[model samples]
Target: MIEHKDYCVPADTWAARVAGGDRRALARVISFLENDDPCGVAALKELYARTGRAHIVGITGPPGAGKSSLADKLIRELRGRGKTVGVVAVDPTSPFSGGAILGDRVRMQGWTGDSGVYIRSMGTRGSLGGLARAAYGTIQLLDAAGFDYVLVETVGVGQSEVDIVRVADTVVVVAVPGLGDDIQVSKAGITEIGDVFAVNKADLPGAERVATELEMMLDLGNHAAWRPPVVLTVAASGKGIPELVQAVGDHFAALVRADQLVKRRLAREKEALLLRLAERVRREILQSWSQEELARLWSDLAARRLDPYTLEERLYSVWKGAKEA
Candidate 1:
């Protein structure tokens, strides 16, 4: 268990190390936080003030959409331009091990020894919205560490992956051929989140068909400040990566011109603040109640003697009492 006295210290030290460009410290801090260590959160809070400096790019799509391959290519392209990159690959949790497999590392070996690039994998941990506070915190750490670009790769299913829109400065939605039904499903989650679309594996027969379908969909959507573009790529062979990178850069530049980035950042800040407040209340306040008190409350609730609103009121009262104590 991490003691309160030791909590702030590791966090502060790790924040400083990240600021100094210590890769290992950055990795360690992220790992610690991914495991929900309290000290890690403290360290993230300490380092949070230093973040919001890097460009955050989120890549998401359906499973087997070749998102990892596309990300690997994007990293290489950014590196070639002399830009330092940080990648956070969010993998699905294995029910048995309860840990991220980091399977995408197979294609990402190109950046293994490159000090200019930092890569880390994260698990969903049952966070429904693809938005893990830990992943967001890791991005902040990389941003504070002075990385030019930070890429967030999320598991390509459910509403959670689409939540990347709230966190990323530029969002890339990847899709593949023969996923006709997928495009429809995507409309519900990711269709609007994209600042750009990537039709990866352009060598495939149905690539053009997929591209045309996506273009038609985008054309039918409500007009925005900037229209999202679709780019084709065979990521394995590095085809069309340059165009993809340029599209990403151009989209970011347009966001700057429209001054929408500021609005997005503000909204993100508000959401993060509320989440932290809720977490604090749940932990320091609600948990202070004795088991007997909780059992009695639940018993009353089960008996329908207490409605949800009343229960919430009681919970808040308990919280207030704990604060006073």
Candidate 2:
């Protein structure tokens, strides 16, 4: 974990700044979240009540599908509608630095001056998945900071990208012409997950054919009530953005009408709980064990005097909330 030891302020102070729309303060909290700081956790508890207002939209697809360009365009259009927007981009890891090489910020630098728009790029940090490990917590922080629309951009690869469904309220899967099935995007899983589809780079030669393919794929889907809409977009020039936003709005409206929004949120939070537990336990559980107990376990395992099962039982006992060895 990279510590931003600069943050010595109280969690409540950061919480106030976040609720008041201080971008720097919000960014600090997100950094703390990635580092798994107790201060960050405390701040989230302080501001958790202000959450559940932002509409989380996930943008994902195969690489070179212009997903980042589309996300940049959406931020512009969403802001034009008087909506405050937050963008969480899960970028590929940098080999040397092991940090996020930001693609979205570079494309959307025009909005950097606008305080209403907050964009964060997160690296996968060696975690093998389409998103940064801390992406879910980052979204909650943004929501509590009062963003009206939060757009999460996935690391465009393949089925690993389907992790977006764990956090997003409405998901947009972007695709381009000439992308074959080589990416191993589990066809059934992809179809069921996308709430909106965009055939980006529509000016390309095979755009129409690709859109048609998507339509046929949509027909095979088992989505009830709300069908995913395929919209063509030249994301670079901002074409078809309004219609795409409306498509997202339509899916969200359907979820609300069916009273499924709360249900989905509950499910997401439940999953988040498991992920958080896994992260925390992996990081701290072993370190918290008594050194004397660990030394005894190692000695017993090496001497061939005690069986491995007995040693395992001792650790299992500690894990089940026993303080004694």
Tens digits of lDDT, candidate 1, 1-325? 3454465575578779888999778877776766666767777777777888788999888777788888888888998999999888766553211233465432566677899998877666555332367777888889989999999887564454336776789999888887775554346655677889999889988998888888988888885789999999999899999999999999999989999888888898788778766766776655777889889888988999889898888788977876687
Clashing pairs in 2: none
Listed in order, each prediction's TM-score against the native is 0.87, 0.83
Candidate 2 root-mean-square deviation in Å: 4.6
Candidate 2 at residue 146, lDDT?
90
Report the Cα lDDT for candidate 2.
Answer: 0.77
- Report the alpha-carbon TM-score of model 1 versus the true structure: 0.87
Query: Which numbered prediction scores highest in TM-score against the true structure?
Result: 1
